[model samples]
Target: MARVTVEDCLEHVENRFELVMLSTKRARQLATGGKEPLVQWENDKPTVVALREIAEGLMSYEFIAEQEIVQDEPLFAAFEDESNEAV
Candidate 1:
C-alpha cells in the first residue's frame, strides 16, 4: 500500500500530453492544496479520467493487468520474452 503523491500524478500527466490542459489544471489545484478528482480530455474524448485514480494510488499494475484484454498473446509474448534478442 504505497502512497501516490501529487508529484507522481503530475509526472504521469506530463508524460500523457494527450491530457495536458486537464492535467495542468489538476496539477495546479493540487499544488494549491486541492485533493479532488482530476478529469481531463484525451484526443477530444473523456478517456484519461484515471488521473486522480492514479494519484490516489488506486491504479495499480495488478488492477489494470486484470482488466486488460489479452487479444494478442503472441505479440505480447514476443515483446516480453527476454532472451538473446534482449542482449
Candidate 2:
C-alpha cells in the first residue's frame, strides 16, 4: 500500500495543521458512513481515503472552513454573551 504524505497534500491545503484537521474531519465523516469517498478502495481506511482525497484536491478548503465557521458560531455567540454580562 502506498503512504499518503503531508507533502503530497500540501498543495491542496495551506498548512499542516489545516490539512490534519480537514483530513481528520473527512475521516470521521467516512467512519460515520456520511458519504461515499471521492476515491474508493477495498482495503483503505477512512483516514487513508481522506488523505487521498486531500492529495487529489477532491475536497475544498473553503468548504471545510465554512463548515468550521458554522460550527463555531454558537461558541462565539456564547462568548459574546458572557462578555456582555461581564461589562
Candidate 3:
C-alpha cells in the first residue's frame, strides 16, 4: 500500500545503480523462491518487495556486492585465458 521511492532507499544505498542491481537480484531470488520473504504480505510484486527490503535495511548490500564481484571473477578469468589463446 505504501510507495517505495529511490530517495527513501538512497540513505541506505549510496549508489543508485548499485541499489537497482541489488534490488533486482533480490527480486530474482524471490521469483525463484530461493529465499524467504523478509516482509509480510502486502500483495506487492517481487521487485517491490525487494525494494522495500532494501529500503528497510533488511538486506545487506555489501554482501550482495561482494557476491557479485566474486561470481564475475571466474568469468573474467576464462575470458582472459581465451584471449591469450587467440593471441
Best by lDDT: 2
Question: What digit string (tens of lDDT, one per residue) describes model 3 on residues 22-61?
Answer: 8989898788846667887488889999888888888776
lDDT of 2: 0.81
TM match of model 1 to true structure: 0.32
Q: Write the per-residue lDDT of candidate 1 for residues 1-87, one digit (tens) a residue.
A: 243355766654444453455544444434453443333323332223345556655544455445445685676676667765878
RMSD of 3: 4.0
Clashing residue pairs, backbone N/CA/C < 3 A, model 3: none
Q: What's the residue-level lDDT of 65 in candidate 1? A: 47
Better of 1 and 2 by TM-score: 2
The total of clashing pairs for model 1 equals: 0
Q: Could you give candidate 2's per-residue lDDT for residues 34-87 as a string of tens digits?
A: 667888656988999999999989887665554453463665797899899998
**Worst-scoring 10-residue span by lDDT in model 2:** 63-72
For each candidate, C-alpha RMSD in Å? 13.0, 4.4, 4.0
- Which segments of model 3 are wrong by more than 4 Å? 62-87
TM-score of each: 0.32, 0.67, 0.67
Query: How displaced is residue 65 in candidate 2, in Å?
Result: 7.4
